[model samples]
Target: MSVVHLHLPGFSFGDVPVLGPLTLTVDRGETLALTGPSGIGKSTLLRIVAGVYPARGTREIAGRMAFVFQEPTLLRWRTAQRNVEIAAKVSPDTALAALTEVGLGACADRFPDQLSLGQQRRLALARAFACDPDLMLLDEPFVSLDAAAAEEMMGLFADLRARRNMAGILVTHDAAEARRLATRTLTLSGRPATVTADVHAAA
Candidate 1:
């Protein structure tokens, strides 16, 4: 069965239209990349799917969801381990395991403020994975990282998905990133935004 089913005619902000006519289904273990230029409502669409944005649609999501924003969004005062514990609602051991998975084991007790940008993003990834989400909403999860770091994180994320069998919708402008991580790609266009292209990869 599909993990997510969305058929939205559209959405608006007051009198200004935001996005819509978005229809798609993401099955378990599938990753769909939502790609578009800046300000074209890609993030807005993800927000809708994550249930954070109210919109006109029939959305049927099958399981628990987690979101990874463009930025790390870690708690400044909290240690890396604490951030994961609070965000994922997991035990300390699980949090530390997740950190280890993301290659942040040695930094688990360090505060977010002490981590580099790349390390901070890795910590965020650890927290998200620790949630054990059935569905993931990723909005430019690799943005702002150096190419090497971004590539490494992408590999780690793919590994996590394989291990967990989760479905996801990722918003990114990088075509290479999309191709590397998603099982399918959806491109949005126009003012209010709609799916202009849908392409799937073979297994």
Candidate 2:
């Protein structure tokens, strides 16, 4: 099992305590759902761990890192398959295969503009999977999907998890997803964020 421990501090509030030296760990083959109020640094924590933030702390990330931002973050100008093709070591055939897994193979020739929001997110997921990442940083992955679509997307993630012993730190607002996907859960403080509660779910 892989464990991640993080410590971060912030000092921009009027009288709020430092954000952290927040510490948490997620084991391999498990998903950790991170939920908290707005502006509580949920995404910030993921970005910091993703190596996008230069804040003070030590992080231990195991294996390849793939990131799915709040938005699809796909190249609008590129075809669906082309986006994954450009970033990963996928050959043309493998890129198609990745898209197929996410049910986007028929839209292979289509660009980002032609797809629906759910489709866009699925494409983003395909691109991440194409890289064969060992860990994924998913920021609200099912934000735009409807209930049926959301369940399907969750299933897709489960399939991906099954393919490998990958772990995810998912930043989402949905408690259902937190309960459904995460083996562990953590809630942060409202103002000056600190890990207020840490919960381990029954798997």
Candidate 3:
């Protein structure tokens, strides 16, 4: 089953065109990675898919959706557990469970500023998981993490997606990350960005 379908006639920022006409779809449980040079509108495309950005296009997304931005984008005033609870609109018990799943249970009472970068990322994942989303849109989610931390987070994300059978769209510049996590990869290029490559990973 297809979880998302998007047909973008184009997108622009004022007079500057950012993306060209494009159409894309993601199947249930599939992970699609968008890769391209920096500032090529990869993240913009992601935002369009997430309905966070407006464009001249059609977008159909089935089931609940969650977004993990390049930064954690958490509420600074909220504790880790509260962040999940509020964002997911779930009970406290449910929130703690989500935190535990992401290895943030011990830090649940801590504020976002109190946690380490990796721990903050985990909390972000916990918030997303707590929402029980069937589709996840991530924009350079592991961008600033160190190698070990990035690897761990990737493993965690893989496990979560497998458990939930979720569809995902990941925007990143890292080819290895795309190869490891995406079932298919799309490369965007040019002044008015358009998909230039579509490669399916070997099963």
Candidate 4:
């Protein structure tokens, strides 16, 4: 069932209009790829739908959801495994499982500093997956990675979502990632951000 829909009534701060009037829905067991150029407020739109945006309209979402920032902001002091288990809602076994699924099981005991940039981001993704969320919000889930590495990670994500029937709203600039993972692709327009183009594919 689709319970969450974001309705934006347009957003502007002083002289700058970030997103126009963007209204989008995150359907159950589907992925929506929000794409745009550099500062088009793609991330901002994700935040808004996640209820982190202070602007207008209401976001209708049910159940637990998780967000992965562009930067993998894992706790520096905690081991990768512990970082994934920090949320009480996430069990230790499940955390380890998520890390394992993301190919980070061996690096679980390593600190954030000990992990490479890609590993850290994978850890962040593992942490989010550990939540077993009904809705997953991702902003540039793949930022710094070689072409092969990025493709591999995207494949993993696709396999995981298919196995779990999880819904993801991902913001990315890469069209390949969008085609690989998204059930739908949308472009944003204006300050508060409104949907400019919406494309959906069959299962």
Candidate 5:
């Protein structure tokens, strides 16, 4: 099934064009990665697809969707478990299970400030998973983590994707990260960004 379909005639800032005409689709259980230079409108395109940014286009998304930003964006006053429960609108039991799945059950009572950066990212993943989304949108989700932490987080995400069979769109500048996580990658470039390359990973 097609999880997302976007046909963007174009997108622009007040006077400058950010993205040119484009069309893309993601199917069930597929991970599509968008890679491009910084400030090249990759994130902007993501927001447009998420309906967080208004644009003139045909944006169709099927089933439930969840987004994980570069930052964890957790509530500072809420405990880890509570963050998941509130953001995901899930029961306490479901939230706890989600925490456990992300290796955060032991720190469920800790607030965002108390957990390390990597742990906070895990909490974000837990919250997203608890929503039981059919499509997951991630924007540079592993940006600041150290090598080991990034690897672990990638592994966790891969496992979750396998278990849930969820479609995903990942935005990253790292080609290696895209190859590792995405089944297909689209590279955007030019003055008004457009897909310049579409490569499928070797199975």
Candidate 6:
């Protein structure tokens, strides 16, 4: 089963202090929504989970993972499908199919520069889903979209998670969105952020 456990001590990034101390667990099929004031090391936490940064405490990730950053992070030179194909290390057909799931099938041949901001975001989701990861790390995946588009993307995220049984950590500032998408929501506080509140969705 997919699982994650993190017990990171107070940490700093460069000269900037990040998180104080945090202990969290995510089991299979759980999406933990993390929220805080901007720049309170929300993304930093995701990076730590992704194993891109070193932390002082024990951290364990027990499954394949995929990440979707705040930015699309696509290759400007590559077509949408090609980008997913390369990053996900999947067949072209599989990549295209993932894009289709995110409503980007018709834009498969377009480059990142040619797609709208929302399309680029969808492309990023396509790449993540293409990997068929057990865990998903998402950082503001719905930023800069109209309400309708964001809602659609949210539905797509739910659909993908159900199809794959993926566990996830979503960093979002929108409380309502967090409540809508996550099984539980956590709020961080202080200079070196720590979880101040955790609320579970109603069954």
Provide the lowest-lDDT 10-residue window in model 5. Answer: 158-167
Query: Mind giving the per-residue lDDT tens digits that candidate 3 earns over 1-203?
Result: 99999999999999999999999999998999999999999999999998889777789999999999889999999999999999999999999999999888898899999999999999999999899998999999999999999999999999988898889999999999999999999999998999999999998
Question: What digit string (tens of lDDT, one per residue) describes model 1 on residues 1-203?
Answer: 69999889989889998786778899998899999889999998889888899777699999888899998898999999999999999999999999999899999889999999989988988998898998999999888888998998899889888898889999999999999999999999988888899999767
**Top candidate, metric lDDT:** 5
Model 4 CA lDDT for position 38: 70
For each candidate, the alpha-carbon lDDT, in order, equals 0.91, 0.83, 0.94, 0.82, 0.96, 0.90
Each prediction's RMSD over C-alphas, in Å, is 1.1, 2.2, 0.7, 1.8, 0.6, 1.3
Candidate 6's clash total is: 0
Candidate 4 local accuracy as lDDT? 0.82
Superior by TM-score: candidate 1 or candidate 4: 1
Residue range 21-140, candidate 5, lDDT tens digits? 999999998999999999999999999989999999799999999999999999999999999999999999999999999999999999999999999999999999999999999999
Better of 2 and 6 by lDDT: 6
Error of 5 at 134 (Å): 0.8
Q: Where does candidate 6 clash, by residue pair?
A: none
Q: Model 4, 4-84: lDDT tens per residue? A: 687777766677888776567777888899987778888877887788867778778888798888888878998888999
Who is ahead in TM-score, 4 or 6?
6
Tens-place lDDT digits, model 2, residues 48-111: 7887866665678777888888788889999998998997768989999999999999999999
Q: How close is candidate 2 to the true structure, as a TM-score?
A: 0.91
Ranking by TM-score: 5, 3, 1, 6, 4, 2
Per-residue lDDT, model 4, residue 14, is: 71
Score every model by TM-score: 0.96, 0.91, 0.98, 0.92, 0.99, 0.95
Worst 10 residues of 4 by lDDT: 187-196
